[model samples]
Target: MPKNAKKKRTQNYKKQIGQVPGALIYTGAKEGNKLHLHVFDYNNEDYKEGDLDSVEEAFRFKDSETVTWFNLNGLNFVNEIETIGNHYKLHPLILEDIVNTSQRPKIDTYQDYIFIVLKMMYYDDSEKIISEQVSLVLGKNYVLTFQEAEGDVFNSVRQRIKTKKGRIRSEGADYLLYALIDAIVDHYYAIIETMGNKIEDLEDDLFTGLTQEEIAQQIQNLKREVLKIRRAIFPLREIINRLEKNENGLIKEKTTHFFRDVYDHVIQVTETLDIYREMIWSLMDMYMTTISNKMNEVMKVLTIIATIFIPLTFIAGIYGMNFANMPELQYKYGYYIVWIVMIVVLVGMLVYFKRKKWL
Candidate 1:
C-alpha cells in the first residue's frame, strides 16, 4: 500500500470517534467522488440492466418480484445512500457500516435482509494491492452492494448473469449474494498465489550470500502484504462459516451448500496465509543468522592477523629497549636475521591455520 493512502485511511478513522453509532458519516477517503449507480434486474426469462441517475429509481425495485441487484459503485454520497437505505428499510447501523470503509468483514442479520461486509482486494496497474470494502444487503427479492470505488472482481459474475451462462439468473437473491462473495473469495487465490511466488523468489536467493542488503526489507514488505491479506480473509472465514450454518429465511437450505463450498475456499486461503506468515518469520531469522556468520568471518580474519603480529611485536619490543649490552644490535646482519625469523613465524602460523581448517 502507498504510504500516503495508508495515512489518509488512518486519518479518516479518527473522524469516526466520539460520534453517534448510527451516524451516516462517511469515513472513507473517496470524498468528492461522484457516485455511480448501476442496477441489474434479472430473472430466468429475461433481464434489465441500466445506470440510474438517482437513488429514487431504485425504489421501484423494493417489491420487485424478480431478483434485483443494485450495485452502487461510489460510497461518498451520503444523501443518495441514505435515500436508498431509508427506502429499503435498512437499519441505521447497517447504513453506517456500509459507509465506514474501515469496517471489518462481518455478517449482521436483520429481519428483512442479511447484511455482509467484505474486503475486495485486487492489484492496481503498479501491482500494488488495493483493498476496497463492499457492503452487501440481501433481501427477499433484491441484493444491494455498496462499494468505495468503481472497480471490482465481479465482472465474471456480471457476465454470467448477463449471458445466462449459469444458474445465477434462475436463483434467488441468496444465490446472487453467494455469487458476489464467491467472486471476491475466488480472487483471493490469485492474490495468494502472487504472494507465494514472491516468497519463493526471495527464498531462492536468501541463502546465496550474494543478495543485496535490501533483501530483508523485501521480506518485511512481503510479510506486510501477507498480513494484510490475512486480516482481510481471516474474519471472512468465520463470517462464511456462520452464513453456511445459519437458519435464516434469507438463506435457502440449498444455498447453504454453495456457501459451504465458499467456506472451504476461505479455509484454504487462511491456511496458505498462515504458512506464508511462518515462512516470512523464518526468512527474517535466516537473514539475521547470515549477517552474524559474515560478521564472525570478518572478526576471525582480524583476530588471526593480530595473533600473527603479537610475537613479532614482542621480539621487536625487547630489541627496541635502549641497553649498552644488546649483543644483537652490534652484529652487522642482525636485522636480516630478524626479518627471516619473522617471515618464518608468519608462514608457520599460516600453515597451522590451514591444517586446522580455520583459514
Candidate 2:
C-alpha cells in the first residue's frame, strides 16, 4: 500500500476506536462553553463588523464582492460546526482535523479552498504558557477561522483591520488570512521571551547553590515546556513555506511576501527554542556535577579522619591484648605513656594533613 493510504487507515482506526462515524468530537478544554461568531467584511473602500447568530447568516456575505472573515470563537458546538462545514462544502476529514485539537501543523489544498492548521500560543496572567489550535480555511473571497476557545491571539489583527492601520483592509481575503496567521506567529515571540526569562532565573539559582533535586525538577519542567513549544512551532516552517510558494491561486501573489516574513519569524522562534533546550540540558549536567563534587568533598573529610585514627586504634588494640607478661602491663605508668604516644601520633598526622592541604 502507498504511504498516504496506510497513514489514512491508521488515523481512521484510531478515530474509530472510541468514536461514532460522522460525529464531531471536541478534543480540547471545555473553556469555550458557548459558541460565538464574529464576522469582518471589508474591501479597499468599506468595512463592517458584527456578530452572527448562525452559520447561515455568515454565508450570506460569502458571495459579496468584499472579503469576509468568519471567526468562530468556540468548537464545542459540534452541530453548529457540522452546519458550517455543510454550508461551505467542507470535507469531513477537514472538519474532523479541526476539532481534533491535537493535530500537528500542516496544510491541505483542495479544489476550492486551502486549509491550514497551526497552534496559537500565549502566556497567561500567571506567566504560564498555553496553546490552542487555530485552523484556517481560505476560499476565493472569504477566510474562515475556527479557534479552540472564545479568547484568541488575534487582537492586533482586529485592531489593524478596525483602525485601517495597515494594508490588511486594502488587500483581499488572502491578505486577511496572512494577517491572522501573522498575528498567531507573532505571539510565539512572547512565549519564547517568557521561556528565556525562566532559563535565566534557573541559571541564577544554580549559582546560588540551590538543591540539586529542586533544580533538577525545575530543569525538567522547563525542558518539557520547550519541547511542547518546539512541537507546536517547528512544523509551521513547512506550512508557511508552502503558503509562500503557493501556485493554486488561493494565496495572492502580493501576499506571498508577507508570508515569507512570517516564515522568517518562525525560523527565529525555532532557533531560540533550540538554544534554550541546549541550555536546559547543560543546567542538568551542571547540577549533577555539583552534587557529585559535594559528595566527594564529604568523603574526603571522612577518609582523613579514618586515616588519622587507624594507627592509634592499632596501638590501643595491641595493648588491649590479655597475654601474660606483657611489658606495658607491667610498667608503672603504661596508661599515661600510651596516652601521650597516641596524642603525639594524632598531632603529627594532623600536621601532615595540613601541610598536604587535605584538611
Candidate 3:
C-alpha cells in the first residue's frame, strides 16, 4: 500500500501533554463507583453518622468544633471533589493530588492543615493484591479522607468511633488521623502474612520434586507482588518521621507518640518486606537448580546404558565379520562357545554394576 492509502487511527487517545498544574484530572477508572460522602461527626458526648445528600451538605463540617471525618469515596467525579476542596479552602495542589491516583506516599504541611497520601493494599476474593491511593487532609477539628474506590480497611476504626470503644471519641482530629493510619498499617500484617505463606509453599513445591516449568510463573507473579508491597509501604517511614519532627501544631504532642507507634509498625513491615524480597529472588534460582538436578539424573542413566553395551557390541561386531580362514567357523561347538562367553560377560558386567551401586 502507498503512504496515502493507509487509514487514520480510530482509537481514542487522551492528551496528557501541555496540561496546567493543579488541574483535576481523574486518572482512575471511568466507570468507578459514584461519589459518596460518608460523614462522621462525633465528640465525647454525641456521635452522628450518615451520608451526605449532595457535596454541598458536607460544607457545614469545615469549622465545626466536633471532630468530623469526611470519608469521600470515588475520585472519578472531579466536579464534586472540586466543590469539597473549595469549601474546605484546600490548596489547588492538594485537590490535584486527591484525584491523581498515581501519587506516592508523602506528607505535606500547610498552615492550617496537613496533606498526606498513602497506599491502601488488600487482597481480593481470589487472593490478588490490590492497591488504592488514599489522600488524607487533617485540620484542627476535621479529617478529610479521599479514596479511589468505595471499599477500605477503616471499618474497624468507624466501629470504634461509633461504639466509643476507646479514646478516639475524646481525642482531637490528629488522633483520628493516627487511628485511620493505624488501621491501614494493621492490615499490612495480614497481607505480609499471606505472602509469607505463599513463599513457604513455593519453597516446599520446588524442593519436593522437579517442578521448574510447573511453578515458574507462580514465583514470578509472587515476586512482582512483593515489589508492589515494598513500593506501597516503605515510603511511609519518611512520612512518619516528618510527623514526629513537624511543628505544624495540627499534630498534638500526645498524638506524636501514637504516630511513633505506627512508625514502629511500619518498620516491622518494611523489614519483613526486605526478607520476602530476598526469598522471592532466590526462588527462581532454586527452581533452576531443581531442573539441573533432574537433567543430571536422566543423563546418568543414559550414560550407564551406553557404557554397558560398548564391550558387548564390540564382541558381536568382531564375530560378525566373515572370512574363509576364520578358525571359529571350522570348530564343531563354536556357536555354543560364543553364546556362553557372551552370557558370562553380560552376567559379570551386571554383578559389577550392582556392586558399584550404579543401578
Candidate 4:
C-alpha cells in the first residue's frame, strides 16, 4: 500500500509539471536540450570566471568564504536541476515554485536560503512585449540565478563583478544579490518611459481630431499594455518591500537600504500605472463625445436639407399635375416665374440659416 501511494504521488507531481511544457525551470536539461552555466567567484581583491557546459561543472568550484554567482541560462532540463538542488540541499517546495513560471513575484525564506521569483519584461525587435520568469536563490556564500532563456539585461552587473569596481566585490553575496535585484528594477523605468511616450502620442492624435473608431482602438491597445505592466510591477513592489524589511542575515543590513531604493522605484511604477489607467478612461470618454458630436452634425445637415426642400417640392408638385384648369401652366412665362420664385425662397432659407448660426 505504501509503494502504491508513493507511485500515485509521483504521478500527480509529474502531471502538474507537465501542464506547461514551455514553462521555465531551475534545472538543466536531461533529454531535450541543456542550458549554459556561468559562474562568477569574487572577493575583495580577487575575482575568477568559471563558465561551464554543465551545472555540475559550475558547482564544483563553490567555496564557503567567497561569493559565487551561478547563472543558469535555460530551463528545459529537470534531472540536472534536481541534482544541483540535491547538492545544495535546496527545499523541494522552492524548486517547485521556481519551476512554475506563472507565479506572482514573491520571496520565500527557507532554513538555509531565500527564494525569489520576478518577471522580466522587454520589448522585442518586432515591438512585441516579452516576459520571462527569473528565479533567484540566495544562500550563505552564493547567489544562484536562473532564467527562462539567455540574453538577459544583467550584463552590467556581471561586468561590475568582473572588474571589481564599486563596493560590489568587497561586499558579501547579499549585496551582490541586492545589485542584481536593483538592476532588474531599474530596467522597469525604460518600459515606463516607453509607455509615457505612447501616452503622449495618443494625446496628440486625439487633439488632431482622430476618428472615433481609431481613438477607441488605440485606447484599448494602450490600456492592455498598461494593465500588463501593472500586473508585472505591482506584486514586485510588495516582494521587494518585504525583502527590504526582512530580518534575514542573508540580506545584509547595509544592503537593505539599497533594497529600499528598489522599493521606491516600485512606488514610481505604481503611480505611473495609475496615471495611465486614468488616461485610458479619459480617452474612452473623449471617443464617445467625438462620435456623438459627429452624429449630431450629420443629423442637423439632413434636417436643414429636408426643411428647405419641403416647400419647393409642394410648389413643383402642384404645377406638375395634368389638370386642364391649371392657370399657371397656361401662362407665357410660368416656368421662368416658378424658377425665380424657387430661387428667392432658397436664398431666404440660406440667409435664415446663416443668421441662426446653424450652417
Candidate 5:
C-alpha cells in the first residue's frame, strides 16, 4: 500500500482506541505552540489589551462588566488550563476536549456557557498547510479561546479589536466569537486558492512533459492536502449551521446572520474542494496512461529490432553447421554473398516497417 494509505490506517486504528470520557490528559503542543496568553477587555467605550504571565490573572475579568477575550496560545500547560477551567466552572469534558486537540469541530451548550471546537488552517511560507485546533468557551461576559500554537489565523480579528475598526469593540462577546470564527473560516479561502494554483501548475507540468516520478509525487501530495482540508472544513459546516440556528440567547439574533454567512462560505469551500479532488484523480489517471503509452512505444521499437535479427540469425545458423558438404561453405565468395543478403533483408524489413507506420 501507499504511504498515505498506511498513514490513514494508523490514524484510524488510533481513533478506535477507547479513552475515559472527561479525562484530563494533556497532549503536548505542537512545535512553536508555546504557553502564552493575550487578554483583550473591551466595551463600547474602552478597550484594554494585556499579555498575561499567569492564568490566575485572567480570572479577575470573568465577572467584570467588560467583555474579556482570553486568548490562550498553547494547551500543553495542563496546570494553567485546569486553573482557568476551575475559575470559570468549565465542564470536565470541555477541558478534556480543549486539551485533546484532535476533537472534531463541534459545539456543546451548557447551563451558562457554550463550548466550541474548530480547526484553524493556514499555509506556511513553504506552501504547506498547517492545521491547529482552536477551542472557544463562551460565557456570560467572556470568551476564552484555546489554541494549539502561539501563532494563529486570528491576527486580523486581533487587529480589529485593537484598532476598534469594526463593530467588534461595540459588540458583545458573541460578536467577538463570530469575528474569531469568521477569521478562521476566511483563512480557508486562502488555502483553497493556494491549492487551486498548485493544481493548475501540476496540470501545466503534466501536459508539458514532466517526469513520471515528479508528476506522481505531486499528484499524491496534492491529494493528501486536499483530503486534509476536506477533513477540516466538512464538519465545520454543521457546526456553523448549529450556531446560526441557535435558539440559546448566548448567540444573539443579529450574530446568527454572520454565522449564516460563514455557513455559505464553508459550503463554497467544500464544493471547490470536491472539484479539485476530481481534477487530481483525473490527473493521476492521465499520468498513468501517459506512462503506459511511453512503455508501449519503447516495446514496439525493441520488438521490431528483434524481428529483423531473427532471419539473419537463422541464415547464420544454417551455414555454421558442420555438414560434410555444405555448398555455400565451399564457395569462395559465399561469406560476401551471405553478408550482402543479410544487408538486403535488413533494409527490406526497415522499408516495410516504415510503410506500415510502425517504425
Candidate 6:
C-alpha cells in the first residue's frame, strides 16, 4: 500500500486494535481494601518523599523535571484507583487492564504514556509458595506501579533509591523502570536457585529408599512447583524480549541495554527450569524402577521358598495317608530319614537359585 493509503487506514487500525483485549487500557483496582501509595521524586542532588493518602495528594506533588516513582502496593481501593486514572489522564482501557489482574505480560504505548503489564512474582518465606500479579503503568518522567498486595521484589531497589547510593538517583524515570524490572528478574534467579536446592534434596531422598507413598507425593509436589515456575517465567521472557526490541519513545535507547540484561536473566531462568524439569522426570522414573526392582526381588524369594516346600509337602502328604500298605509308616527310621530329606531339599533349592543368579 502507498503511504497515503496507509495514513487513511489509521482510524480503522485503531478500531481493530481497540477490539483486542486490554489494548492500551488500565484496569482499576478491586474494591473493599485499602491501596498503599508511595511517591519518590529524586535527582542527582536532591529528592522529596511522600506517602500518598489519596489520588489528589499523589497528583499535587508531581514534578515534570524530576523522576517520580509512584508505587501502589495494594489494588483493593477502587475509588482511589479511579482518582489516580483521572489525575494521570490514563486511558479508560488502561484503567480496565489494571483492574483485570489476569492480563498477560504486555507492553502498550499510548499517546501520553506507556502501559506495561507484567507479573511480579516471588516466594514468600513464611508461606513457602510463589505469588504473582500484574504490575502496570509508565509515563514520560513518572512511573506508576500497581500490585495485588503490599510486598514485592522491589524492596532492594527502593532501598537503593532512598539512599541515593546508585545510578537510580541520577538516571531518568526510564532507568528507574529498568531497575524495577531488573529487581524482579533478579528474584527469578532466587526462585530458580531455591528450586534447584529442593530438587537436589529430592534426588537424595529418592536415592535413600523412600516409601512408594512418599515418593509419589514428592513427585507430585515437585511437578506442581515446576509448573508454577514455568508459568511465571515463560511469558516473562517474551516480555523482556519485547522491551528490549521496543522502538517506542517510552523506552529510551539507553535503557534498552538494561532490558537486554533482563532478557538474559529470563533466558537463564528458563534454561534452569528446563533442566529441573528433566531432573524431576528422571527422578520419577528412578522411583518407579526402584519399586519394581524391590517387588521383583520379593517375588524371587517367595518363588524359591515355594519351590523348596513343594517336594517336602508331597513327601509329608504321602506318608501321612491312612493306607495300611504304606511301607514308610512301618519303618522306625522313616521319620528321621524324612527330616534329613526335607533339610537337603531346602539347601539344594537355595544353591540352585544362587547358581541361577535369581536370589
RMSD to the true structure for each prediction, in A, is 2.7, 6.4, 5.1, 8.0, 3.2, 10.2
Clashing residue pair totals per candidate (backbone < 3 A): 0, 0, 0, 3, 0, 13
How do the residues 162-193 of candidate 1 rate in per-residue lDDT, one tens digit apiece? 99998999999999999999999989999989
Candidate 6 colliding pairs, count: 13
TM-score of each: 0.92, 0.87, 0.91, 0.87, 0.90, 0.86
What global local distance difference test value does model 6 have?
0.76
Q: Write model 5 residue lDDT over 183-240, tens digit each, in one string.
A: 9989999998999998888888778867457778888999999998899889988788
- In model 6, the Cα lDDT at residue 236 comes to 75
TM-score of 4: 0.87
In candidate 6, what are the lDDT values of residues 121-240, reduced to their tens digit? 677865366565756677778988888676688889878987887788888888988898888778878877887887788778778876457767777787888887777778877677
Clashes of 5: 0
Best by TM-score: 1
- Which candidate, 5 or 6, has the higher lDDT? 5
Query: What is each predicted model's overall lDDT from 0 to 1?
Result: 0.89, 0.86, 0.89, 0.79, 0.86, 0.76
**In model 2, where do residues sit more than 4 Å from their true spots?**
1-15, 18-23, 29-32, 44-46, 322-324, 327-333
TM-score of 5: 0.90
Consecutive 10-residue window with the lowest summed lDDT within model 3: 9-18
lDDT tens digits by residue: candidate 4, 1-359: 67456432222244465545433343322324347788898899899886787777866655658899998866666666677777888877766666666667888887678889988887778655677778898888899987867778788898998887789999988898888888877777877788778777877777777774566767787888888878888887778777777776778787888888888888988898898799878877877877788899999999999999998998899888879998888899999999999999999999999999999
- List residue ranges in candidate 4 displaced over 4 A: 1-34, 212-214
Whole-structure CA lDDT of model 4: 0.79
Q: Estimate, for each residue in 179-270, the C-alpha lDDT of model 3 and write its tens digit.
A: 99999999899999999999999999988884956599898888888888889898999999998887979989998999999999999999
Which whole-number lDDT from 0 to 100 does residue 145 have in model 2?
92
Relative to the unseen true structure, what is the C-alpha lDDT of residue 206 in candidate 3, on a scale of 0 to 100? 85
Q: How many backbone clashes does candidate 1 have?
A: 0
